[model samples]
Target: MSTQQTISKHLDKSVIWLFVIVFLISASVFAYRYKNYKTCEDVAFTVKAKEFRVGELIKFTDNTDQAANWEWDFGDSTDVKTNKEVLHIFNKEGEYKVRLLVNNICQDEKTVTIKEKLFIIDSTKLPVFNVKSSIVVGETLNVEDKTNNASTWEWRFGETTRVNSVEKRASYVYKTPGLKTISLVVNGDVKHTTTKQINVLPIEKKEERISEITGTNRRLGDGIKARPLGYEDKDKEKTKDEPSDKPKVVPFIGDSQFISKLELVSNNKLDANAFKEYFCGDINKNIIVNGKNTSFLIFCEKIKNKKLRIKDITIYREKGSNCINTVTISQNKILGIF
Candidate 1:
């Protein structure tokens, strides 16, 4: 071959070698990308929750690549949700297996624990007893439970009989009563325990009933008629000396009181008149916080510059005592209670 023809042949071989190298490099890169795509097709996600309390809303965010659809199984036997960012609520307290299905092809799962929320028992939310703080021994005491979100109840009558009941409404006749500590737990959760004190009077010390009519008098006819029934002679006395029939008013000073009032309102313990006493403005807004549509009462408990500026306040009407369910307040408010 001539020298020019040999050089041409060497150049063609060199070009062919360069093309083969480029093709190999391209194939390697394509393989790597395809492997990554397959790995990504199996959804990658993160489940974030600030709290895991029952009845709390949790948000799950999908961070998967090339994901076209998202499906979530909260493991509560509820409906499955399809969204890039899904919100879920667990009503019961337990460990829930949360599964995420991406594009109906790949799935990932996480276990979340739902714990019982710490609840501050309010007396106004509890059942009202027919008997007063003091009752006679062997007297039947009637109690009606009016608590909110309560599915079950356990009551300890605090007598020597060791009596207990699971009914929402119960009556107990105490055989012996002195200073008794009556306790109740709702929803079978010990976190909802409430206790109160009661006094039982002995039968021997019972007071005699007074006659409706007065004894005979010499000066006046029928002893001046003994005044009219339900008539109070003290009414003619000074107002300060006479007791008022109105309920004692308690001022809302800090966030603790505000939260207490909110609980009372939610549990149907507070009437409309009492509701207006703590809150100043209209509280009928349907606002949502933390993905819940229920009513929430939020406030700043700290007195900044000797004045408190009310923050987010939401209120809505529901059918039962669960109307006002959630409450969020300043940290100072909780500290102030102590």
Candidate 2:
């Protein structure tokens, strides 16, 4: 072969090999790019901000696995950050689109809103009111809101979970005896509410309780009020009973109230006397507790030092005078194994 023809032939062979190598390299790169695009379904990240407001610092963190390269566009500014985590502050209050480019391929976007500054109110400067700290049951409890700027009022008398009154000056008569909480929400702002506590005292020993009913009450039946003083006939009790003037007054107590008082007695905060009005003014009224027979006063004393979980409580009342007839309780003593 001629010398020029041999050299040209070698050059042609070298050019063909170069083209084959370039085609193989391009095909491998295209396949790898296609695999990465298919598996990048979950482009996950987290944004942490104590409060999303103007001038607040917001932290953006990329949570994608095997994410080596990061591109964060906070969307508020044209600047982009290349880091796994970045902190940015928005200068204005509005919604902004946030975007992230993971490993220069996986792309995702989210929206963040910056809010205006919230109005702050001093809770100490909230409306104040006045009420008597203690009052007898059946007596009217008067309250007056003294806040000068208060035109609307919401009053809740802790006896029930309800708004009892709306006037600036309110009054309520308690039917049961115990501590009660009174709340006032002025200007319809319940967040800055003012509250007061009042104690409704039971009828004292000296207080006179006239029987409104005409029929005579059951006297010392079924070991109830074990004392021999006949409650029905004053004439029969004039000689047998020790007291001659004052009629024995039993304070009226609701079934729910009785259960609460029992809990207080278990905590040692109260005693059997707390339920005097429930049982013909006799704390020692006979009753059944968890199928065990015992006096009311003795039952209270038994659980006085116990931490108890009340399982069930039942109260029976005389239909005539609404006086407590029988009480059955089922309570579990907690941490009192001995």
- List CA RMSD, all candidates: 15.5, 17.5
| Candidate 1 ranges beyond 4 A from true positions | 1-38, 41-43, 117-120, 127-157, 164-338
Model 2 spans with C-alpha error above 4 angstroms: 1-56, 61-99, 107-121, 205-338
User: Candidate 2's residue-wise lDDT over 127-206, tens digit each?
Assistant: 78888779998898888888878899888765554568999899898888766667777887643656666777987778
Per-model C-alpha lDDT, please?
0.59, 0.74
- Residue 43, candidate 1: how far off, in angstroms? 4.2
What TM-score number comes out for model 1? 0.33
Candidate 2 overall Cα lDDT vs. reference?
0.74
What does candidate 1's lDDT look like per residue over 235-280, in tens digits? 5666767766744433433445654554554455542234433322
> Cα deviation in Å at residue 167, candidate 2?
0.7
